[model samples]
Target chain A: MLIETDVLVIGAGPAGSSTAKHAALNGSDVIVIDKKSEIGAPKRCAEGVSKEGLKKLKIEPSNRWVIKELSGVRMIAPDGTSVWLNEEKVKLPEAGYILERKVFDKHMAMDAARAGAKIMVKTLAKGIRREDDHLVTTLETMGEEFEVKAKIVVGADGPESRMGRFLGLKTTLKPKNMESCAQFEMVNVKMEDPDSIEFYFGSVAPGGYAWIFPKGDDIANVGLGILTTETDKSAYDHLLEFVKNNPSTQNAQPVELNVGGDPVGGMLKELVTDNFMLVGDAASQVNPLTGGGIITAMEAGVYAGEVAAAAIKDGDYSAKKLSKYQERCEENIGVKFKRDLKVKDYLQSLSDEELNSIADAFHDIELDTINTAELIKQLIKVSPKALLKLGKLF
Target chain B: MIIMKVNEWCMYCGECAGVCSRSLIEVRENSLKFDKKKCKECTICIQVCPVQALAKEE
Candidate 1:
C-alpha cells in the first residue's frame, strides 16, 4: 500500500506529535507514525518542566495533566548545609509543574489530529528507500507490511533513532554525556512540602541527582539519575536506599518503578539532512544540566513542522533547506545549550569536597533564582581549587 | 537495606548535613564527613549535596 503525504513524521512523542500538529496546521498534508500501539503509553520522563519552556511551544498548562505547581526549589550541600538562595521570590504565574507525561503527550497528539494530521499507531518505519526525488519508507503496521512515500520526513524518534544514524550524522554519545535514570512512584509517603520539588546531589547519585517530585501530600515520584561513567552503581540501587532510610517515605508502598537513559548532550551534529530533520532526543535537544527535553522537543517539533510545510510549498527538500530548523533552534537556544554543556562538563569533574564547598558558596538556589551560569561562576569564585578543572570545562 | 558510601571527592559543603534530618553528616577540618553508623543511609545527603559526592551501596 503506497500512502503518500507532503510530510511524514516518525515517532509520536512530544517532538513528533508537535511537529505533525504544526505542519498540519500550516495546510500541509501530514502523516505521523509511531511504533508504539498507544500514542502516549509507557511514559519515560521525570515530567518536570519550566513554565518558560511551555510558553515557547504555546502550550497552556492544563489541570488534567499537571500534577502540582511547585512553590520553590531547594539545593543541599554535601555536608547537609541547606540554603535557600532564590529566597527573594516573585510569584511566577506559570512557575513549574510535575506533569503526567502520558496525558500530556496524548493531548499534543489530539491537537495534531484535530489539525488534520493522520496518525497511525503501531506503525514502525523499518527502512527508507530514496527513489528519485521522493523517499519511500517500509513500515510494519500491526503485523502487516506497507509502504509510504513523502516529500519530506521528520525524525522525532527518541534517543534510539535510526533515522539520524542511517543518514551519517554523529549519534555516538559518550558515557559522560548520558544519564541512566530510575524512578519509583510511592503512595502514602510523607512529604515535607508537596508544593516544592526536592533534589539531592553528591555521592547518592554520582554524575546526576535524585529528585522527589510530589504528586500530592502522600504521593510522590522519587527518582535518581546516575552518570554511567561517574559511578558503578545503578540508578535503581540508589533510589532503593533513598526509600529504605528516609522516614518520610520509609513505610510507603511502591506503586511503580521506571528506569531509562537520557542523552545529556545538547544537540546533534546535523539535525537536518536531505529530505529529513530530527527533533527531540533524536536531535539531542535535552538540557545538559537538567536532562529535560520536553519543551525543547516541542519547540523543535513546531519548527520542523513549519519548515516541512514551507519546504513542501517551495518544492525544495534538500539538506540545505531543512537546515533552517537547526538554525532556528540554534538561534533560540543554541547559546544557552553551549553554555549548559560547558557547565555539565565542569560539573562531572568535581570531587565531593569541591561539590560541598561550591554548595556552601552559592547555598541553595530557589525557584526565583534559577540562573545556572551565574551560580557556577559564584562557585568558581569561592572554590579556587576547582578553577583548574573549570578552565578545562569552559 | 540502604547502603551509604561516601566517595573521595566530597567537598563538605554541609548542605547534605543540613538536609539530613537523621544527622548523618558532619563537617570537620573543612571536609564533609559522614557517620556511616548514624547515617540512616537515606541517601538524601547524596541527592541534596549538589556536588554528587555521596553514593548508595547496592
Candidate 2:
C-alpha cells in the first residue's frame, strides 16, 4: 500500500488527532497512524484536565468521557499540614474534570476522521528517509509493509518518539529533567473530599509529588512522579509506600496500573526542520510543575496543523517556513513553562521543614481575599529563606 | 561489549526508549528491543525506568 498525503501524522493521541483535524479542515489531505491496535488502551495519564484547557480548544465537557468534576485543589505537606484553595474564590480554572482517557482519546480521533483525515491503527513507522522534495516513511502493520509519502511529517508520538530521532532531532531527556511516574486506578477508597484533587509534597515523593485525582465517590487514580536522580527507589516503590502510608488509600485495591516517563523540563529548542514538525510529548510541551500535557499538546497540534496547511499552500516546506509553528507555541505556552520550571526547581530544593513552614503560612489565610503577591509577602514574613529563592518567579 | 538488559519486571511502558540518549531502545507490545551494536552504555535508560526493569550488562 503506497499512500501519499499532504501531511502524515505518526500517532493517534490528542496531539496528532488535533493536527490532522485542523490540517484536513484547511484542505490538506492528512493521514494518522498509531502502533496500538486500540486507540487509547493501557492509559499512561491520570486523566486530569482543566475547564480552561477545554475552553481554549473549543471543546465542551461531555458526560461520555468526563467521570468527575472537581471543585478545588488541596496541597498537603510532609508533616500533615495542608492548604486548600477554593476554586471559585481563587478564580483559578485549575479545578476541572477527571476523564476516562480511553474514551476521550477515541472521541478525539473520531473528530479528526469526521474532518476528513485518514486514520490507521496498529501501524508502526519502521523508518523514514528523504526523497527529493518529499519524505518517504516505511510503515509496518500486522504482517505486511507499506510506505507513506508526504510533503509534511508531524511527529506526535509521545515522550519516546522514534519518529523524532529518525528525523535527526535531539529529543533525548536528561535524568534530572525527566520524571519517572507510576499510577494505579484504585477502588474502595475513603476520600475525605471527593470533589477536590490532592497533592502530597516532600520526601515521600522526592523532587516530585504524589497525586490523588478522584474518579468517583469511592475510586481514584493514585499516582506519583519522582525524579530518578533524587532517589535510588523506583517510582513504583515510592507509590507503593505512599499508598500504604496515606490514610484514605491505605485499604484501596488497585485494579489498573500505569507507568511511564514524562519530560518535566528541557523543552526542545527546535521543533521543526524541513518538512517535519514535532508536537506533544515529542516536543516536550508538558507543564514543568504539574507534568500535564494534554491541553498543551492539543494547542501545539492546532498550531502545527495551521502552519502545515499554510506551508503546503505556499509550496514551501522548508525549516524556515515550518518555524512559524514553533513561534506560535513559544508565544502561547513556552513562556509560562519557563517560569514554571524555575518554580519547580525552587520547590525541589526545599527541605521537609521548609515545605511544612510554607504550608503553615497558607493554612490560616483567606486564600480568596489575597493575591499572589500578597501571599508571597505573607510567606516571606514567615519564612525569609523562601523570599530569596522565590524572588526569581516575580 | 556492553548491552542493555530488560528484566522480567519490565512493563513495556516505553519509558526507557524515550530517554535513551542513543535512541537504541524500542518498546514493542510485549517486549523491548535494544540495538546493542549502537549502544554507548550511557545508562540513561536504566535510570529512567519507572519499574527499574532495565540494567547495564557487560
Candidate 3:
C-alpha cells in the first residue's frame, strides 16, 4: 500500500493525536499510526492530571473518563510524618482527576479522526529515509508492509523513541536522568482520604517517590519510580517493598501491572530536522520534578501541528522552518523544565533527615495561610542551605 | 562477549530499549530483540527492568 500525507505522526498517544487533529484542522492531510492493537491499554501513566492542565488545553472534564476527582495532595516524609495541603486552602491548581487513560486516549484519537486525520492501529514504522521533497516511511501492520510518503514526519513515539534515533537524533536516556517506574492498579485498598493523592518520599524510593492515586474508595494506582543509578535493586523490587511496608496498601491486591521508563529531564536541544520534528516524550518534554508530561505533550503537539501546517502551506520543509516549533516549546515549557530539573536535582540531594526537617517545617506552619511563596520561605528558614541551591528558581 | 537475556517474566514494556546507550534493543509487541554484536555490556537495562526480566550473561 502507498499512502501520501502532508504530515505523518508516528505514535497515536496524546501528542500524536493532538498533532494530527490540529494539523488536519489546518488543512494538512495527516496520518497517525501506532503499534499497539488497542490505543491506551497497558497504560504507562499513573493517570493523574491537574484541572488547570486540562483547562489549558480547553478540554472539559467528563465523568466518562474521570475515575476520581481529587481535592489535594499529601506528602509523607521518610519518618512517616505526613503533611497535607488542602486544595481549597492552598488554591493549588494541581488538584484534579485520576483518569481512565484507556478510555481517555481512545477519545483523543477519536477527536483526531473526526478532524479528518487518518489513523492506523497495530502499525509499526520499520524505517524512514529522505526522499526527493518528502520523507518515505516503511511500516508494517498485520504482516503487511506499506509505504507512507509524508512531506513532514512528526515523532511522538514516547520515551523509547526509535523513530527519533532512526532520524539521527540522540534520544537515549542516561541512567541518572531516567526514572524506572513500576505501577499496579490495586483493589481493596484503605485510604485516609480518597479525595487526596499521596506521595511518600525518602530512602523507600531513593531518588524518586512512591505514589497512591486513588481511583475510588477501595482502589488506587500504587506505584513508585526510582533512579537506576541510585539503587542496585530494580524498580519492581522497590515497588514490592513499598506495597508491603505501606499501611494503606498492605492488603491490596494488584489487578493490573504497568512499567516503563521516563526521561525526567534532559530535554533535547534540537527537536527538528529537515522535514522532521519530535514532540512529547520523544522530545523529553516531561516535568523533571513530577514526571508529568500529558499536558506538556499536548502543548508541544499543538505547536508542532501549527508550525508544520504553516510550513506545508509555505512549501518549506527545511529544518529552518520546523525550528519554529522548537522556539515555541523553549519559550513555553522549556523555561519551566530547566528550573524543574534544578529543583529535582536539589531535592534528590537531600538526606532523609533533611526531608523530614522540611516536612516538619511545613507541618508546623498554619496550613490555612500558607502559599507556595510562604512555603518556600518556611523551607529556607528550616534549611538555610536550600536558599543557596534554590535561589535561582526564585 | 556479553549477551543480554530476557526471562519469561518480561512484559515487553521497552524500558530497557529506551535506556540502551547504543540503542541496541527493540521491544516488539510480544518480544524483545537485542543486537548482541552492538552491545557494550553497560548492564543499565538489567538495573532498569521493572520486573527483573533482563540480565547480563558473560
Candidate 4:
C-alpha cells in the first residue's frame, strides 16, 4: 500500500504531533505516524516544565492535565543546605509546575488531530530514502508494509534518531552529555509540601539530580537521574536506594516505574537537509543542564511545521530554504541552551565541597527579598566566568 | 516475572529505559546496564529498542 502527503512526520511524541498540527494549520497536508499503539502512554519525565514555555507556545493551563501547579522550586545540597526560588520571584526557566505527562502529551496530540493532521498510531517507519524529488519512506503497521511519499519529512523520532542519520547529520551524544533517568510513581507518599517541587543533589545522584514532584497531598512522582559514568550501580540502583533512605517517601507505595535516557547536548549543529528537518529530541533540542525538552520540543515543532509549510508553498524543500526553522529556534532558546551547556560543564567540574560552599553562599537569604537578578549579581562576585554563564539559566 | 538482559548489539541509546515497568535497566553514557533481579521480563524494553540491544533473559 502507499500513502502520500505534503509533509510526513515520524514519531507522534510532543515534537512530531505539534509539527504535524502546525503544518496542517498552515495549509500543508500532514500525516503523523507512531509505532506506539497509544498516543501518550508510558510517560517519561519528572513532569515539570516552565510556565513561560507554555505561555509562549500559547498553551493555556487546563485542569484536564495538570497534576499539581507549583509556584516554587527547592534544591538540596550535599550538606543538606537548601535554596529556593518562587514563581513570583524567579526568571524565564525557573517557574513552573509538576505535570502529568501522560495526559499532557495526549492533549497536545489531540490538538494536532483537531488541527487536521492525520494521526496513525501503531504505524512505524522502517526506512527512508530520497527518491527523485520526493522522500520515500517505508512503514510497517501490524503485519503490513506501506510506503509514504512526501515533499517534506520531519524526524521528531528521538535521541536515537534514524532520520537524522539518514540525512547524514550528527545527532548522537557522548555519555558525558546524556542522562539515564529513572522514576517511581508513588501514592500516599507523604509529600512535605503540596506546592513546592523538591530536588536533591549529591552522591545520591552523582552528575545528575533527584526530583520529587507532588501530584497532590499524598501522591508524588519520585525520580532520580544519573550520569552514566563509572557509577557503582545503575540509575535503577540509585533510585531504589534513594527511596529507601529518603524520609519523606520511605513508606510510599510504588504505583509505577519509568526510566529513559535524555540527550543533554542542547540543539544539534545541523537539524536540516534537503527535503528533511529534525525537531525536538531528534535534533538534540533538550537542555544540557536541566534534562528538560518538553517545551523545547514543542517550540522546535512549531518552527519546523511553519517552515515546512512555507517551503512546500514555495516548492523549495532544499536545506537553504529550511534554515528558517533553525534560525527561529536559535533566536528563541539556542543562546540560552549554549550558555546552559557551559553551566552543565561547570557543575560537573565542581566537587561536593564547592557545591556545598555555593549553597552556603546563599545561606540566611530571605526568600521574599530575593530575586534571580540579585542572585546572579551575588553569584558574579563569587566567580565571574562561572556564574556569568549560569546567570541566564534561571 | 520481568526478566531482562542486554545483548551484545546494544548501541546504548537508552530507549529501552523508557519502557521498563520498573526501573531495572539504566543507560550508561557509553554502555547499557540492567539489574536482572529487578527485571519483570515484561519485554516492553526489548520491543522498543531500535537496535535490538535487549532481550528476555529467560
- Best-fitting candidate, measured by DockQ? 2
Cα lDDT, model 3, residue A359: 91
What is candidate 2's lDDT per residue for A278-376, written digit by digit as tens? 999889999998998889999999999999999999999999999999999999989989988877888898899989989998887898788889887
Score each candidate by Cα lDDT: 0.74, 0.89, 0.88, 0.78
Candidate 3 lDDT, A134-244, residue by residue in tens:
999999998899999999999998888888788788888887878989999999889889999999999999899999999987999999999988998888999999999
Look at candidate 2 and tell me the lDDT of residue A250: 93
Candidate whose lDDT is highest? 2
DockQ score for model 1: 0.02
Q: Kindly report which residue stretches of model 1 are placed more than 4 angstroms away from their true locations once superposed.
A: A85-95, A364-378, A385-394, B1-58
Model 2 chain A lDDT-worst window of ten = A86-95
Going through the candidates in order, what is chain B's TM-score? 0.69, 0.90, 0.93, 0.74
Using TM-score as the measure, name the better of candidate 1 and candidate 4.
4
Q: What is the alpha-carbon lDDT of model 1 when measured against the actual structure?
A: 0.74
Q: Which residue pairs in candidate 4 collide? A: A259-B17, B1-B40, B2-B39, B2-B40, B2-B41, B3-B40, B3-B41
Q: What's the true lDDT of residue B38 in model 4?
A: 62
CAPRI-wise, candidate 4 is incorrect
Alpha-carbon shift of residue A353 in model 3 (angstroms): 1.1
- Could you give candidate 1's per-residue lDDT for residues A1-394 as a string of tens digits? 8998999998899999999999999889999988776676666667888776787667898998987877766555557655542214643322388888888898999999999999988787777878888888888776689988999988776765666555566654555556767778889888666677777777878888777778866888888888755765666778888778665678888887765557787787678878988889878788887788888888888899999999998999999988898899898766678877776667666777877877776664443555545654676687764566555544
Give candidate 4's error at residue A345 in angstroms: 1.6
